[model samples]
Target chain A: MIDTVAGLAADPSGSTAQDVVLRAENVHVEYDGERPTRAVRGVSFELRRGEVLGIAGESGCGKSTLAYAVTRMMKPPAQLTGGSVVFRDREGRETDLLALEGEELRAFRWNRLSMVFQSAMNALNPVTTVGRQFDDIYGAHRPEMTKSERAERTKALLEMVGIDAGRADGYPHELSGGMRQRVVIAMALALEPDVVIMDEPTTALDVVVQREILDEIERLREELGFSVIFITHDLGLLLEISDRLAVMYAGEIVEYAPAERLTDARHPYTQGLLRSFPDLVGERRELRGIPGSPPDLRGEVVGCAFADRCEYAFEPCRAVTPHLLDIAREGAAGWRAACHLNDPEHRSSVSDAEGPQS
Target chain B: MTALEVRDLVVEYAQSRGKPFRAVEKLSFTLEAGRTLALVGESGSGKSSVLKALSRLVTPAGGQILLGGRDKVPAKEYRRAVQMVFQDPFASLNPSHSVDHHLRRPLLATGRARRGTEADTAVAELLRQVNLTPAADVARKRPHELSGGQRQRVAIARALAPAPDVLLADEPVSMLDVSIRLEILNLLDDLKRQRDLALLYVTHDLATARHFSSDIMVMYRGQVVERGPSDEVILNPKHPYTQLLAAAAPRTGATRAEVRAARQVRAAARSARDAERRETVVGDGCRFRPRCPFAMDVCATRPPEAALGGGHRVLCWLQSEGKAAA
Candidate 1:
């Protein structure tokens, strides 16, 4: 249960490098049209087995596009310009996701890499019963399984999400929003996929409902031992459930750290995002949101995408694009930030900054 | 000054079968000028129903909505004094229409501004107020051309075109980005203060509700479980449901044990929530009793309105029992 707040179970130092279930290296996705948009720009991350890696960013920050690209779910016009999405099986066989096509690609998804969309109602067929949906998955994947096995599996999955198995007979509209979301989750886990990519799965639900769903996801991830990539704009919520976080801005990861250390991030965008949410337990103070809008990525960006909004942006920030540099944070390996402030030459004492501490 | 007063407001929908569904049951509240009241609830909690009723989109089955301390007011007058900013800016705005037309129509319809330079200046001023600079550039652009944040600003601008005394914003920033959400909320807060508008903010997010609103009313299945000053209600909740909401909200720097404790209580409640559908008829009992951790025998019937001073009130049997002692 401590894993929900601080991951004692998901401590990566205990895990081996071989446990990397999925790795994306220098991933790039572009939407080619009249006005071309580079949705993802050289984003890279590793999803270790049994670890919850949260991709935190706002809308159109390319987090979703990155997810779709990594999973090889990109449709026409939106193509993966460059990247290697390597999926390493438990038996130590690496499969290139971008190379897989047709039957192999269709079989790969839900068998290994599954996705839970933002809206469950949209994901689920309104016309079909929830039980039939599970049966359909079983029919498609586990064709050798008996009818009774499929039925029993459906019952167990429904019960796993704390929903009554009897409700499987009901349509998506018959169940509540939370129940529908839970059903979608249950279906996603039907095949017991190695990695589940949930993109804002609980955004539309209420606070209580979202919390319950998150808790359930954490529980199921522990019980089943599967890695998860949870994406959301809610930095506060992400801080709670994630073992490690990747904060993205305008298609690039600005900061990567253990969930606990994100509040003390070196990136101005991450800090601004952390401050954006009003704490439910803290002293009430007025929050001044970050001013200015994100730069249009349709055209080439010369420097930092967040430079226009950064309070600490200086001369070098506008002229040069900051690369992701390793920062020092105790007990957290791979703590990095893409900011000029991370460099000593660019470091200057600001009223809010915690200057250069290893 | 009381800008709007609502007493025993009951909103019902005609069901195909059985009795009419009571979406809101005897809800009572007063909105003061230059103050924000947040109605916090999940789906089926009737926060939307209340918004619909307040905006005159749906007539209440019962109760009186007294604007400026009077129940009787002209329809045009009521409309001019009360305006709404919808949840989805994309759907709220017409795709074919420009930003100028949206703001201009409201101003002209309400007699806030006339056609020609008067209307043009009013539209530009409205756009400027929302921080959409070089007003002419933004005014000419259609809704599709603008970003989500900019479109929301235009929606706010459109809402302000009539210069209403009350602004009903329904999840105005939920659809927006994290960084942009605060910008819109801060803009709304500034506009509220500047215009001295009575703002009724309805949303599912507790953190924003507590921060943006002076008062908060936590609703559960068409009934308010708790109502109080924002900080008091969130910081030290008297009701079980409100307590759950406060604890369930994800916050930075939360202790593991605290989360574990919340999770343990949630196990039983999750099952209860799954088993129980939100029935139209709540039957003269505490609405939160189904999910309440500390539900007693008295909760089966009706709980007393236990007042915890400072305008904080709870409709829980536990509060009623511990009132004299605590």
Candidate 2:
């Protein structure tokens, strides 16, 4: 079904195609119902071989939906409407992910790109021991391995993620949430996949535990040299860990930039998000959150989806749909923003003191 | 005036085994009108237990909850005096009932509003207070019709329907989106000041906790290991556990190096705590001894409270020993 328009042309993601691990090109997803919700609208980005790309947005912005579409995990009612996901193997062979089917799709996942699902830390089976569950995953993916080889691999993976290898016999109930999450991550890494997608992996956990898990993932990514696509709504956190960030609003990528530049954001929605939260290490100041909620994406959206809530929305913002355009200063690498203010003709009158250089 | 005072609060869950699990102990604090106190801790650190004991969700094994200098107040009056704003506003509001019903019943039951006309007027006023415009339209809609932030606002308005003196919020904004969190938080802060309501905030986000509250109490496994002015606790932490938390906080200006350093601190702390918790026999002294890097011989017994001046205090052997050395 996705064969149409897929494998169109290669996405130009700053980096050359050789180093790009996973490239999502113009994807769209919808939750079909009485009023269909367009969850993802033409989202695209590239994952470098050993870099971390962060996708961030609040609930209903479709960050999670995009992940589901790209990973072939979309269920009924949630349809992957359009676009392409190209996963480049370590052998430099490109496979159109959306086109994979049956056993080919099954073999593609876990062996190439694995995902540690949202709240996956607590997703371990209670009745089965941690080791047994890991062995089962190995049994499915690596049928050629002997029983002892699978057991040895499980212990090694557990140890790599900082879990005690001996605790493999323990049930999910006996281990803490953090430990359970570690086991899930270990299982994801068991196949030594080239890319690991973690969606809100540290959410709802204790601060100490959240920090500990992030540290382990970073260490593993460094040692194994696999790329990561870390998804979360915590913008501040994404800014800290991710090398590049894609800010989404109303099911569209509003801003894509290097993490540091994102702080001095080019898009008003991204700026609104940065200004929304109270800073931990700074002088206290008054903060005004973006007024009004996100616009409903269930129906036909006219012009800019964020214009109603945007502080700088003008006449053109209501009439013209803004596409992602390069808003970076001359010579700067990768900064694209979907806002009329970035357009020379439609730029807002009150220019930022640190606005982009042509 | 002190709007609410809690003394030696203890919350214990009865177990089928030998002893009941004491979820909270030695927790005592006072909330004066027009002030915000943040209780900062991880899960199972007794943050919920504290809120639960205050709102009368679970009967505390021991404690005196004093509102206006009386602990013997009736259940009905206590309910009116103390109100709670729970997390997950989607779950907090009734989907079957209209917003009007959610607020009207509480307003009339507390005698804050009369029947029919007066009740309608009062509900409109509450909705207006939360910035839910054209109260007429919002009042008729069910919880499903409203957005998450709006639902939270409705929950806040409902909590305020009875005109409570003390407001206990347990992770109220955690469920909302990143862009709308400040709207709800700023609203809560504004209400706290406008109504002079004593606010007790419970959360794990160190940054927001320190930003919103005048005082911050850091909890570890049922006991408060550190307490001080919010800025002081966050900036110059004494306890090792507090330092770990400060390191874990996500900040705007943290460079990649700083993030890596924080990660290093967390990884080291996790391993150290894991090894110590398994080997150390932490009898009754400091609950954090297992995780405390600077654990000493006297940690087996309760450490003496050391005053760090300017309303700051810490329950750690390191602080006390350092004070003696100084």
Candidate 3:
């Protein structure tokens, strides 16, 4: 029902112009493959300007699919079946990202919405100089800017990413894996895009490099005021960087809340995810992994996507697909979850007085 | 005696010219029977090199690996004693071969399980140890047929097929998802405890290392920068690099603004010191000085003497008493 931009803002605190750069409503994506899978089912959220919105889930959870849908870059076999992605441009026009086609789609890319993929290093032209690649992207987007102007801008971008400007002239092969990823990020930001979708950008890099690259990206986002749709399997990283986070399970958002709430999550899926992660700063103990694997999205999914693995899954969970509903009526801040326990009417019948909260 | 003991372990990769590249520099640790010792480091820090050297996948340039206090000079016996579970399950297991084919071959090769009843029981036991249910069905399945977690279990089961005294897991769960990650870690922990098997876990994940191992060795560029009780090293880390690593662990509860601010400070600090830190540490001298925030004049030239006590060791000029050697 959250069809309009104002409807998205109505869910929480009044979203100002400075807030909510991208708002997705009831997004449902399906892969019309040989098996015709319903990959993402009724997913919705908002990415405020200058804020990082983290989408966290295990593989095949459709967090990456959600990111792809937002960028209007969903690959073949994967089709955007329903819903709309409303993104406000710097020019103050609300563009329905899903509606764009052909030339408009190409122009929208890198200029308004950019993406830094999981293996971003692989995206770079291995033979070309990093400087030239940056220039090419910059030149393509801003044809009026001269070569000298492009070069000057490229150096600044490289320096902004904490990479030495001199090394921009070096080929992708010459740069370290971390350095190349940073260059890719710099290229994504070349056009000063309003929204940047990163699909596990630093997943391949070592811990130190991962930290460094994420740090640079965080810095860049702050300086430029671009909304970031950061997707990753590591909930820890998302929890740290994201203002709000959406936990996906089998192509659906099982939990959606502010980043702080994720740690003390009410959703069973979120709790399971939290328990699974080995904490760096905590009592050293054996982590209890969620038993069973994620369900195959290729098959006919009835009821909840997580029913097969969920400890708290009941008859209702296996009977019907739970819609994203606000869990807490008063205490929580616009917290929504697709789990049955979070259903509004379900909460009304259960006496809060004797509930576990006490 | 400890199940596996790596004494002053040094491994150097042979280069085309000049001195061989020292991958592991004078590393030493022991895993008591039924305990896990996690060796943690970044890409070039020689974590995998140590594991490979132990399993004889790669030959050590110097030092010795002792199996039951005796040097494992003959590599075959060591391979039988210690089996490695590699990171990539898909690549490690043969796709063409069925699960039973992969499982039964190792048991037969090691002579731990003979054909017929004993071999079948052992295979079932191996599957049970890693929590792969319906053992009979799993035995016939191929590597591609199973999910990532199940594939990892098959790899672990295969390692156990030989009844190895020690398990060397090189980032086994890194490729798996977070939800499934803990299952693998728990399985390893259980296997170590139940069988009294020593485990040498190599990983870059400090959090997982802390969760699984009692003792931890933090390596930086082929040298052990810090080694001690996992809690002490991870929580109250004395080394500058360890401190940075602990700080870099993405905090869950922090707002985007706070996290972004901290990330900026860390990036600035890393950039400010990266180049000077790259210049090869002076041999027989403190290697951490260049990157150290509290580097002094003595750190530039003098090698900090080791301070070892209660299964803990730290090499830093600050920890040194500055007393002249006898």
Whole-model Cα lDDT of every candidate shown, in order: 0.87, 0.85, 0.81
Ranked by DockQ from best down, the candidates are: 2, 3, 1
Q: Please give the fraction of native interface contacts (Cα pairs under 8 Å between A and B) kept by each candidate.
A: 0.73, 0.81, 0.81
Candidate 1 local lDDT, A1-358, one digit each (tens): 1111132223345665479899887888899988789889988888899989999987889999999998888898899998688999899899999899999998999999899999988999999899999999988999998989988999999999988889889899998899999999999999999999999999999887888899999889989999999999988888888888999999988888888777787788888888889888788898866777788889999888898988778777888888777676667677778888886656653433443332
Tens-place lDDT per residue, model 3, B1-326, is 49888888889887999888898888887878888888888887888888888888787878878888898546667788888899999789999998888888889898888998988888888887788889999988999999998999999999988888999999999998788888898889889888899998899899999989988989988888888888888988877778877887777657667876787687677767763245687666667677787677776664554656656677676676773332
Residue A224 of candidate 2: its Cα lDDT? 93
TM-score of predicted model 2? 0.95
iRMSD, per candidate, in listed order: 1.6, 1.6, 1.7
Candidate 3 regions with alpha-carbon error over 4 angstroms: A1-9, A16-18, A329-332, A347-358, B253-261, B264-277, B323-326
**Better candidate by DockQ, 1 or 3:** 3
* Cα shift from native, residue B295, model 1 (Å): 1.1
Report the lDDT tens digits of candidate 2 across residue range A1-358: 1221232134334577789888887899999999999989888778889999999888889998888898999999999888889999878999999999999999989889888987754577888899999888877888999989988998899888887888888888877788888888998888999999899998868887887788888888888999999999988889988988989998988888888767778888888888877788788888777888788889988999998988777788888888877664754466788888888877745466534322
